[model samples]
Target chain A: MIALRIGLAALFLMIAVTVQTSVLTNVAVAGVTCDLTLIVVIALALSRGPEWGAIAGFMGGLLLDVVPPADHTAGRWALSLAIAGYIAGLIRRETSGSPVGPLGVALTVVLGTAVSFFIYSATGSLLHDPSVDWGEFGVRLGIAAGYDVVGAIVVIPLVMWIMGRVQPARERRRVAP
Target chain B: MLKDLGSPSRSTSSRSTAPRSAFRSAGEAPLRSAGTSRDVRRRRTVLLLVVLACFTLIVLDARRSAGSPVEPLREAAAGVFGPLESTATSARQPVDNLRDRFAEMDRLKAENEKLKKDNEDLTRELTTSDYARNRAQELDKLLKVAPAYTMTPARVIGIGSAQTFSHTVTIDAGTADGVHTDMTVLNGTGLVGRVVRTTQGTATVLLIGDRNSTVGGRLNASMALGFVSGRGEVGGTLDYKLIDPKARPKVGDRIVTWGSSGNAPYVPGVPIGVVTSVTANEGSLGSTATVKPYVDPTRIDTVGVVTGPPARAPRPQLTGKGN
Candidate 1:
């Protein structure tokens, strides 16, 4: 079950990150690319709770950080995404049956995006980069958050279905009753 | 149906890891979230390790002097992603061209660069033409100035730039053309070196830019005497130690050869070069300046050799051009 889940997560991460870095770079809206990797991480987090979610987020974020055309400090994204993913898991743990409404997915996406951007900008400022153009940065973040929210509705359910298909027999038996 | 749709989002259909005993305790909550303290501790440790690993990577990248260890990873990613990006762009080109006149900005940028390069080439051509026209007038003036000494025009077959160490050239005019060793050489503007060696058909003329060569020189404005010698590179220098301490030669001063005895090696009143930089002498009690030569040794193509004695046939009266 663990192997199957990990394999599926790895595949999804590769597709999401590759598309986010390569394809989405050109198709920009208001100078912001849709962070599909962030959406995938959110979906994985919602599907799996804190521990696995944090693991998935760390690995996914690390890939994003190391890939080519990466301009910022390495590990900045890793830290932000890991925390965001963990928070997402914690949200699932706090809520019963983890609900399916678009409202919930949208909130998680916005909140996750906000957390990631906040950490990224804060880390940049701390590292002596004077990222003082709040107006432009804020607009991009806002657009990205909105973009992620829209992606969440489709992503969350899709990821859940895939997870169900790949569920281990032992776990499936345990949950069947 | 809505219940199934809503509950399935939690991925409850996936096999649960929790025991049935814990399942009743947790009711509908996911099993991983309701873990023992051991699970909590393990999760904390993994999270901490991930953060620590990330922090280490950040520090490693920041301290990267030339290239980071992860550079290969980035290269591999680029190798993978670059072609993918290219493929996507190519695929989109047709659809893109159909809408909004695709790649307008790209075409404009290319056109801008081409226009900029064209403008630069045109400007360079105009400058070259202006230089050629002015050089023609200077050569014409030379004929009127020194009419007594017969001038043998020889094409500069080889330039000093072809040689690594010495500023010397082989001219087409040599012994066959009445050229010999020690004949004074000049071009449209000023002093080229005298003939150093001559073969059956070609001669090598030493230029003032040669370190072994020096010319007895006089400043045009102050009549101050100094020796101009080559640095064996491009320009020569005017020795200031010989000049009187009271006299100061300013920048842009003209230097002309103060003719050798009987005008054997170099003729008199021939312009050598112009002063470009003046600096206080480090060890001596005077100022020294660099002179950019009138004839660029590397660019010489056509030259004249004085085959005989100084122009004693009634010196041409000094005119609008300098003596």
Candidate 2:
């Protein structure tokens, strides 16, 4: 059952990455875009718990880094995402009766955005690109974060509903017998 | 049937066993001990993974030329989820189609009205003056000296995700259309970019304005040579040594490609841009200039790929005294 969930998550993650590359990128909102893959990672983390979330985040981030025409180092994304996942998982553990619905999603999206932007900023500073001005960084970060939050609000519930329906009831029956 | 045979004995043994409290205490002690160790180990593992990821990024980025082995893993992930991507795209196609239909109608109406007015204006202008004829003659002369390069038109399919550092565009032409790595791409007016990667039927072009993009260019009128490097924005900077500090380059001077060393990549004489501004510093030996690219990359629909040797080669050195 664990393997099945991982496989399903991986499949969805791939879809998210491809769509992000091909379609969602073209649909920009005020010169900013929603990172759909990030939304997927957060969703998986929330639904499947922490360990799986971190793994999914790492893989998804690597996929995003490799597919895009990026100027930064490769593993920058991998590390950022792993940290995001771990943090999200920890948050999940701490919150109680946290209505696993819209409120939960909003929190996850906001935190994920913050973590991604912070990691990128640190990495850029280290790289010494003179264009890494704080003002521009703040604006871009806000745009990305806003878009991601919107994506999470819309996508998380729909994914949860789908997973709930498709979950393998047969496994529970096998264990009982 | 095997479960049924063992079930009776299991129940009987449970009834005959020592009190539940005795077993419970023993179980609790070990469970608590094991849980703490497991938690510690898990935390250690997570920390180790984070450290490794950061270390790898730093080491790889410090290299003069770096490309990560993680690319294959990314590709594999994409391949695995290709089907889901298609489904999502298809799901959104209906709405897109509806929006496009209305937009197309509006565009056609505007185009028709503009064309009708243009025809009347052209007819009146042609009768009144020889301006069109003179312009055509000049254009003909220019064409003879430097013929327009061959082109393979392409449609932009995608743009880069991270807009902070560089700008990239993906086009619908690739190796199948005779496109190759590092081939110069140009729109009607000037250079656009070079092909970075190619699949069977699609290619990604790294735009000239991308932070990493650099091209050898020269001023058309003065023949002043310089290297044009992207400023991580809409414009590029010309870095060149001027023999005279007073060599003031005026605005609107054309910039053209100086070509490559051996011409395996870019062909020469492709228009790059026009000088928008120039600044000279007394402390510095050379001046810096800004270039406004002729092609508005945001609206580029069709582009030409220049193929062949560079227009000029390095001058050969005389062996002894001048003949």
Candidate 3:
């Protein structure tokens, strides 16, 4: 069952990466595209707990870093997403087992995306990448977080539903609430 | 062992002391599976190790070059994911066509207006002088020189920016199709970019609109040499820095590639853009101007890679003004 869950998460992440690169790239609003992979990482982290979240986040981030047309450093996304997943998992622990409202979910996704983009840019500047211009960071961060919030509304529930389906019946009951 | 037991008990007590009575009052839902203290410790350790590994990889890949160790890993990933991207792109073609059709009318209207204006200007120049006719023919021949080069056409299969923060596209031609790093890629309109990385079946093209990209440019009117750098936005203006401090560049001047050492990255005489604006301050290092590129980097669907330059160079033509 654990293996099945891992497999499910990996499959979902790969699809998210492909779709994000090919499809979502054309659906830009304000020149910023939504990040489906990041949302998927957060969803898995919230469902499975911190350790699982970090591992899944690392894998997803690594894929983003190495995927075709990705010319950035190899581990920048991995570092950012892993940290994002860990924090999101901590949020899950803090609000353990309690049903969160739509507002709570939106807030979490926004904060998570904002923090992740921040870390990515911060590390980029530290690494001396000329692309990380701080002058545009604030506006880009706002647009990226806003776009991701819209994606999370549709993606988070779908991921949770799939996660519940792959679990045993007894575990499903625990996950359904 | 005793100390470990004490710490776990203390941590568990601290965990239970949180204000959870309100949540528990509603109903008991096993949202979280209970884990032993060892599990918590192990999870934290795992998180630490993963983060450390990422840091190490980042530092190692910070200065990527032609022969970096990360190149193999990047190529391997491209080989694995290239097929998936191509499939997804092909499957989405119908939807893409619908979107394109909606914008087609406006684009065609704009193109018609521009062509009509050009026709009027050419007719007037033709009647004015034989020199104008010769210059026009020279411009035509320069453009015709493109077919002389060996070219490979490819379709764009993916658009990506989430990871790199730069504008880039994945094309469905790679080493298998004679596409390689530093090859010049262009569309029907004008310059697109150069290939940066390639797998067996796919290649990554770094668009000229990326902030990190810099291309040598020559002013069409004044023949002044300069460097053009992207402003980091698709369809945004490019920054051109003149090489000669004494050379004065004006707005409305055209630009083209100055040609690289072997023309591997950029071939000579490829049109880049027209100057849109110029800065007032003329520093010791020459003036700067903004250029509006001929090709809209965002809207390109297909591009051709120049595998080889023309066998012989075209004779340099003179403008009506003496060189």
Best by lDDT: 3
Which pairs clash in the backbone of model 3?
none
lDDT of 3 at B122: 38
Q: Which ten residues in a row have the lowest lDDT in candidate 2 chain B?
A: B314-323
RMSD versus native structure for model 2: 11.1
How many backbone clashes does every candidate have? 3, 0, 0
**Ten contiguous residues with the weakest lDDT in model 3 chain A:** A92-101
Share of true Cα-Cα contacts across chains kept by each model = 0.25, 0.26, 0.65
Q: Write the per-residue lDDT of candidate 3 for residues B105-169, one digit (tens) a residue.
A: 56545554554344335324432343234356555654454325667777788886533567789
CAPRI tier for the interface of model 2: acceptable
Cα distance off (Å), candidate 1, residue B278? 39
Enumerate the chain B TM-scores of all models. Answer: 0.49, 0.58, 0.72
- lDDT over C-alpha atoms for residue B316 of model 1: 35
CAPRI quality level assigned to candidate 1 from its DockQ score: incorrect
The runs of at least 3 residues in candidate 1 whose Cα sits more than 4 Å from the true structure, single-residue gaps closed, are: A96-100, A130-132, A169-177, B1-34, B93-323
Interface RMSD of each: 21.6, 9.9, 3.4
Best first by DockQ, ranked: 3, 2, 1
What is the TM-score ranking, best to worst?
3, 2, 1
